[model samples]
Target: MKTFCGILWEGVRKELQMSFSAFFRLLLGALKSFLNAETLQCQVFTSDEENGQLESRFISLVSNDDHKFTCNKKILSSKSDVFKTLFAGSENDQCVRFQEIEKNLIKIDDVDGETLREILRYVYFDVVDQNIMDPNPNLPFKCLLAAEKYMLDQKFKDSCQDFLVLSVDDENAFDYFRLAENLNAEQLKLSVGDYISQYLTHKRDVLP
Candidate 1:
């Protein structure tokens, strides 16, 4: 009787093991079938018009590598709220870095020099809006040179001073002075330095 009971228990255990294996195999097969059906359903249901619309929307929202003017205009116009999404309330170094990246998006086509300049001008205005002065002397110095050139071409003496004063060091300041002198903007040059100096003096006097 004991031998028979032991054999019966072994048989029941083997049956359960086989049943579990079969159950798992069936479950796996079902899952695979479901995934395959889903993929096929997606492919079969996508109409040509829907797919074309999707492609058009994607092209409009993202930068067009072939015609960069489209992308540039979109950025400048604040179209599709992409930039707003990216830089909502972001400032300082983060904003500066974003502006730099935006500058890189300007196209280098044969007749796009004005577009490039406009992008640079946008960057300049961004810096001004954030009251950012380059911590690195080199960057601000380069900016001063650019500002001087821009002012000479545009004849914007006041704007030139704004960039010149940002150069920070005496040498850069003198470089701005020379450029101003060459442009015959002596009065504007003197006024710009004096204004910045007075502002600095006031700021220092207020500091504890």
Candidate 2:
């Protein structure tokens, strides 16, 4: 009877030891998973903060750079011609209309940096080629077409967004305009137009 009791006590001790080992292993695994999750979240947040800072710098460049240029050729090459034709360059003239339009465009904030560069490039080339403003009424549509071609020639996201901002208003704008234009499509072009229109018109739920 004494031998049986001793053997029973030994078996109980071994079982307790195994149970404790298993519990400890599970606890360690849970701790590891928690640490890994926390680390991943921290990395993502850091990346997002960095991106926000970069975007702020880009916006400052556009707003403070005094971009004395426009997307129209006539405006760049013959600022006088545009002024004369549109406003007669008179003190009490239509030049104010252009100025107002410019002021509004300038007030636009949050345009992507790459998009601004692409738009600047397009405007620069248009000035060189003397094709900024089309003689025809369909010129805005043509601008969209030109933007598509430009985006295709150069693979950049910034240019595409600039083009979209400038041309999305026209009724003739294409459905897959970004794809056709060779522009970078970070998001759907239609969605972009919807957002812009909403801001401009103060109408929400108007996105297609």
TM-scores for the candidates: 0.28, 0.21
> Which whole-number lDDT from 0 to 100 does residue 1 have in model 2?
53
Task: Give one digit per residue, the lDDT tens place, for model 1 in 29-135.
Answer: 99986554322122332688976543322211111233333222223334223243333544534223232224234222222333233334443233232232334
TM-score of 1: 0.28
Q: Write the per-residue lDDT of candidate 2 for residues 63-150, one digit (tens) a residue.
A: 2234422233232223223223432335644234332333213321323333344345544342221332333333333434444433
Q: Which TM-score value belongs to model 2?
A: 0.21
Angstrom error of the Cα, residue 67, model 1: value is 17
Cα deviation of 21, candidate 2, in Å: 92
lDDT of 1: 0.44
Choose the strongest candidate by lDDT: 1
Per-residue lDDT value at 153 in model 1: 32
Relative to the true structure, how large is the alpha-carbon lDDT of every model?
Answer: 0.44, 0.42
The Cα RMSD in angstroms, rounded to one decimal, for candidate 2 relative to the true structure is 20.5
